[model samples]
Target: MRKLLAATLGILSAVGGFVDVGDLVAASQAGARFGMAHSWVLLLGVVAICAYAEMAGRIAAVTGRAVFDLIRERLGARVALLNLVASYVVTVVTLAAELGGVALAVRLATGVPYLIWVPVAGAAVWLVLWRMRFPVMERVFGLAGLALVVFAVALFWLPTDWAALGHSAVSGGQAGQGWGAYWFVAVALFASTVSPYEVFFFSSGGVEERWGTADLADARFSVLVGFPIGGFLALALIATATVVLRPAGLTVTGLEQVAHPVVLAFGGLGLAIAALAFFAVTFGAALETGLSAAYAAAQYFGWQWGKRVSPREATRFHTVLLVSVLLGVLLLLTAIDPVALTEYMLIISAVALPLTYLPILVVANDRTYLGDRVNGPWLNTLAAALLLVILAASIVAIPLAIGTRMGQ
Candidate 1:
């Protein structure tokens, strides 16, 4: 029971990474435009993230270090600092996007404007980080995020064409959206699923919880079970959109449109449930991204970090967390469209994926870190293949964005 509870960190990280604002829009857009053709991308991303997260968890449990810490050691401070700069920028932008998501979810639930909720959301997220017990925080949000299962449930209630959905999953096409747009959405959804912050939060949460070799099985169990569940929820979002939005020619311009199918099927009750799920996942992601931003900086500098210590003890880390949330709030105050921000966030995250992932692959195989616990042959094979796909996504992300004019 204790071990099972510890998996909350994995669940929180996966739910945040797999279905935050980015996935909510990207996955639905894929479905709205291309049916279930992009389902394979989500599946591949789940496999990739699971394999790497298992390695990251193993490293943290055995070595008492997170991925960013290993990067500084293996790649030298100069290169790692550069890596940190890129990662920090991407993460802060991601933090901003999540804050916007939280506000949007609030606006969906209440009649108040989303801008009014931005700072409130940021303050609330910071408060939770400032005072909550780490595991308690993880479990609360992870459990709440399961409210997204409403999407899957709503699917069953709706008159879904199961055979057609399965056929589209097996036989992918551009659905008249053009291969360029199709692949662009594919890359974005894939990037969201394997977002770097997921691993950062996952491994850092393990370290914060003081995982050891004895906890390795529990960590692995978390990634294997938690992430796929996240992927399933995301797939349900896609399936719902395919069934309800595609034929209507709706393109999911915001969170409200994402909830349309459920609202149509179950009316007001469904809208309320969708809003709760949206708030939980986005607020949970805001927490993860804020921590991930600080985690990257603290781990890079070898500073004292983790919520296990007093705020005064880890002042620099906590300061970064506070500042990151403030920055996010400020970004949202500029009144940028949260959906558009998420689209941009996904593209940039795609470009930065290799910087975050390559070092993990290298260090996971290093006996210096894990000794006999290093990645086994099959894991290495999968990690290497996934790295190639990540690289392809990174190499092409900007060009595709430019060429397709952000997948017009």
Candidate 2:
């Protein structure tokens, strides 16, 4: 049971990573428009995230240094600071979206408006980060996120055409959505599933937990099992959306629409469960992004971080974390639609993909860092192929968004 609990920690991190608000919007959008056509993207993202996460965890265990630590050492202080700025911006944007998601969830459960709940949600998230033990926080949110499985349950209860969903997953046609729009959705889905904050949080969490060589196996189990489970849940979200929303030609613009499939199957109760899942996953994601912003900054500057020390002890890290949350709150106060912010975040994440990834790949191969634990020939080949895809997505993301007018 003890070993199982540790394994569960990894799964918790993956669940937090793969299903944040950006994904809640993107996955539902993909399913509603392209049906299961982009399911492969989620699967590909799962594989890619797991592989990279394993490497990051391995490096953390063996080197006793988190990803951003190695990132600074390799990319040097100046370049790493630049990476910190860009990544911090992306992480903050994502944090705002997730906080909005929490508000949306609260609004669904009660009749309160989302705006009313926004500040409340942000305060509650901040409190959790401030006082909660890290592992306990992970377990609670991770388990709550599993509530998303209700969507999968709704599928069986609803009149789902499983065979057609299978066909679409294997065949990546546009289903009349147009190739331009199809690719746009593809980029969004790719970016959400492979959000860079996941890496920052995962590697940093390993360090916070004091993972060492003996803990490598547990870390590996967590990434391999946990992230794939997250991908499966995300895949289920798309499939449910495809089955219920696509024929109506409905595109999701908010949380209510995203939860429509579940509502159709189980009415109020399903809606309740869906909302709860949204709150948990998004809230969990908000914490991760907030910390990731601070992690990137502190790691680059070679300052102390993590909760092992008190806020005063890691003053710089805590200060950055607090500021990051405030920035997210202020951004939302501008009344920009959080959903729009989420979509835009995904695109920008696509653009900055290489900055986070190239450093990891380079560090993963460093003999001094990994010793005999470096990636093998075949793993490197796969990483290269995946890197090519990431580059293509980054390069075309902007052009496609423009040409498609943000997928009209």
Candidate 3:
């Protein structure tokens, strides 16, 4: 039972990276604009994240180190510092976007202005990080995030054309949207799926929990089970949008639009459930991204970090966490659109994907780290192939975004 509960880290990481505010916008935009044309992209992303996360979990369990720790060792301090700079920027921006999402969700539920909730959400997230047990924090939000299954439930309740949805999934047609726009959404959704912070949080969580060789099986189980469940929820979001929003020509510019299909299916109750799910996933992601920003900074500097220590003992780590959340709230206070911020966050995440992933692939195969536990032939092949895809996305992300004018 304890092992099962430990899976919440994976669940939280998956939910935060795969289905957070970014995915909520990107996935629904894909479904609304291009039907199921990007379904294959989501599937590919899930496979990539699972493969990389498995290796990350294994590395942490065996070496008692997280990805950034290995990165500094393998890449040298100068190069790893550069990597940390880029990663920290991306992660802080992601944290800002997630805080915006939490505020937007609050606005959806209470009809209050989202800006009013920004500081409230930030303070709450920081408080939880300060006082809560790590596993307990992850489990609470991860389990509550399952409220998103309401999307899948609403699909069955609505008059979904299962056959057409399946056909579109296989067909990969762009539904009159240009190829540029289609690929734009694909890259955005793909970036959300394999966001760098997910791996950072996953491995950091393993280290924080003191995973060892004995915990390897439990970590693997969590990555395998938890991430795919996140992918399923993301797919349900796509399917719901395809059924309810595509025909209406809606483009999902806000959380409200993302919830429309469910609203259509069950009215007020569905809206309430969708709002709860939105808040849980976004708030959970805010926690993950806040920790990830701090993790990268601490790991790169070789400072002692983790929730296992008291705040005074890990003052620097806790300071970074507090600052990251504050930065997020401040960013939202500028009154930027949370949904738009998420779009920009996905684009930046796409460009920075390889920096975070390449180190994992290299270290996962290094016998120095894992000894006999190194990635085997099949995992290596998958990791290598996924690396190629990630590189393609990175190379093309900016060009696609510019060419499509942010997917028009």
Candidate 4:
């Protein structure tokens, strides 16, 4: 049962990575505009995230320290501080986008105006972080998020062209949409899949739960199972969009449009499920980004952190958590479209990918930290190869966004 409970951390992390507000928009848009042309990017992202997250989990388990804790020690204060600033800014922006997503999800379920729910969603998420136990918080939202599987079920109910999707997945193309736009969307989707906050939250959660060497198998299992499940769910989103929205030449302007395939398959029942899934994923991710922002700050400053202690004891950590949530609420109250905010956030995240990931690779290879448990040759090779891809995405993200006017 303990092992079973441990899986929820990966599930919640994957929920934040693959099906969060940004992914719902990016994945659906990929399918709608270019069919499955961007499928390879998603697959690549899953591989990269799973590999890095495993390294992170192992570091937490073996060293009895979180990634950021080691990062500061290994890379020196200057580089780590730069990474922290970039990561923190991007994470807080992500938190705001997620808060807006929660409000948007509520508006979909009820006819309430979105702005009215922004603060309400912020308050609810803050309360959950303040009151909920770590394991229970992870388990509840993680399980609820599986409701997105309805999109996969919709694939069978609809007349999906399986062979066509298979062909598109392999024979990647720009679909005459210009390579600039294609690559822009690819970067965005990749950024959504391997967001830095996911790793921050994953490693911190390991520390929060007191994982040790004995828990390595459970951590690996969570990484192997949880992220692939997220990739599959994300693929279902792409496939559904390819089947329904692409054919209709529809644009994915909002979450409701993203759910249209499911709605077509089961009508009102599908909408209900999609709404719940949206709320679960967005709300779950809000908790993750909120905590991740706090964790990164606390870890960097060498302040006391984690949920293992009382709020009064971890005053600085809890204060950062509160302030982050308030910032999210304030950002959302400005009424920026959550989907648009997600696109911009993904672009910035893509540009900052190297700052977050390169240090992980360096730390994972350092024998001082992992000793004999350090990454093997094959994993290092693969991780290095993926880092090059991350660098390329970072380099081209802005140019592609500008050339394509944010994918037109």
Candidate 5:
């Protein structure tokens, strides 16, 4: 039972990452316009994330250290700090999007304006981080996030043309949308699927729980099970959107629009499940991005972090946490639509993918860190190929965004 519980924590963390606000919008947008052709992006992303996250978990279990800590040691403090600044900024922007997602979910549930729920959501997120037992928080949000399976269920409930969806997944083309727009959605969906903070939080959580070599098997199992399930759920989001929203030619502008497809299939009850699913995933992920932002800062600087210690003991870490969340709140106060900020963050995420991933690939082979446990030949080959694809995506994200006006 204890093992099952621990595995659930890892899966929950992955699930939390898989269906956050950015993904909820991005996946739906991709599906509504491009159909299931972007499904491969999620598959690619899940593979890449699983590969590196396992490396990270191995490092944590073997060394009792987090990825960012090794980043500074390997990449030098100056470079890691610079990476820290960029990663921290991007992560906080993500947090703001998630906070906005939570607020939007609340509004959908209660009919209150999302703006009115923003501060309430922020405060509630902060309170949980400050006061909740870490494990309890993980379980509550993780289990609730499973409610998102309704999206997959809704796929069956609706009049889905299964063979058509399968054909789209297999045929893999832009259809009516230009290839530029198609790939743009692909990049955004991939970025959202394997966003950097998920790795930072996952490996750090392993370290926090003091995972050892014995725990490594459990860790790998969780990633294998959790991430693919998460990816499957994301695909269902797209499939649901393709079925309901694409016919209407609706563009996704918020969580509400993302939920519209489900609402069409299931009515108000579907709306309720979708709202709760969004809220739980975003709420859970807000915790991750918030912690991950701080974790990177602390690990880079070699300051102690994790909820096992008091805030005073990890003052620098807690300060970074407080500051990151505040920055997210301030960003929203500027009155930027939260959904739009998510789009920008996804682009920025595309740019930074190599920065975050290169370090993992490098460290995974460090004999000093892993000894004989370093990546074998096949894994390295796969990792290198994926790395090239990520760099290509990073290089092209801006050009495509400009050429297409962010996929107009």
Candidate 6:
């Protein structure tokens, strides 16, 4: 029972990352623009994140330390500091994007402008982070996020061409969108799939839950089951978009378009469910990113951290969390389009991907940490190949964005 319950950690982490606001838009955009051509990217990202997150969870369980804690020691202070700065920036921006998502979700429901809900969403997220029991928070939002399954169900109800979808996945062409735009979308989706904060939150959450060697099996279970579910949900979003929006020549300007297929299939109920799903996932992710930003800072500096400790005891960590939420709120108040912000966040995350992932790969192999529990040859080889892909994404993300005008 405990093991099953513990799976919430993985589910929440995956739910938060895979279906977060940025991913919601990015995946939809990919499908709308390029059909299912980006399916391989999602698959590759799931494999990469699962392999690394398992390493991270194992490290946390075995060493009683978060990944950031060991990163400074293993990678040197200078490199770790740089990584910390980049990751922290990306995470906070992501938090802002998520808070924006929460507001957008509310707006979708209430017919209110999303801007009015920005501060409200920010406050709600901060309050949950400040007071909610960690496990309760994880379970509540993780389960709620599964509401996105409506998209998959809609595929059957809609006039979806499964054979065409399969051909798009297998053929893997540009769909006349041009190679640059396709790869731009590819990098953004990849970044969203393997966002650094997901690992930060997952490993830190493991340490907070006091995972030990005995809990290793549960940790592995979380990684294996959680991330792939995220990928599957994301694929469903892509499939729906491919079926509905692509045929109509519509692009995902907002969540409304993303929910269009569901709405067509189920009408009012579909819209309601999609809005609820959006809110839960975004709010859930807001919590993860906020805590992750604080975790990265606290772990990097060796300060006290984690929800197990009271806010008074972990004042710096709590302060960072509060500040991050506020920043996210303020950013959204500027009326910057949430989807645009998410796109920019993905570009930055793609560039900084190597910094967040490379260290985990290095430390996972270190005898000082995992000993015999270190990655086997097969996992290491897979991780290495994935890292090369990450590096390629990082190198090309900016050029592709510039050349394609952010996938214009």
TM-score of each model, paired residue for residue = 0.97, 0.98, 0.97, 0.97, 0.97, 0.98
Please list the C-alpha lDDT of all candidates, in the order they appear: 0.89, 0.87, 0.90, 0.89, 0.87, 0.90
Model 1 bad stretches (over 4 Å): 1-17
Q: What lDDT score goes with residue 105 in model 2?
A: 88
User: What TM-score quantifies how close candidate 3 is to the native fold?
Assistant: 0.97
**Model 2 lDDT tens row, 1-408:** 987766776677677667888778999999998889998888888888877888888888889888888888898778887887888898899899988888888888897888888888778878888888977887788889999999899889988888888988888588886999999999999999889988888889888888888998888887888888888889888989998889888889889989999999999999999999999999989998998889988988888998889988999998898888888888888888888989999999998888888888888899998999999998899888888888999999999999998987
For candidate 6, write residues 248-363 as lDDT tens digits.
Answer: 99999889999999999999999999999999999989999999999999999999998888999999999999999999999989999998999999999999999889999999
lDDT of 3 by residue, 133-195 (tens): 867667667777888999999999998889999999999676677888888999999998999
TM-score of predicted structure 5: 0.97
Candidates by lDDT, descending order: 6, 3, 1, 4, 2, 5
Candidate 2: the clashing residue pairs are none
Give the better candidate number (1 or 6) by lDDT.
Answer: 6
Runs in model 5 lying further than 4 Å from the true structure: none
Report backbone clashes per prediction.
Answer: 0, 0, 0, 0, 0, 0
- Scored against the true structure, residue 163 in model 3 reaches a CA lDDT of 96
The stretch of ten residues in a row with the least summed lDDT in candidate 3 is 9-18
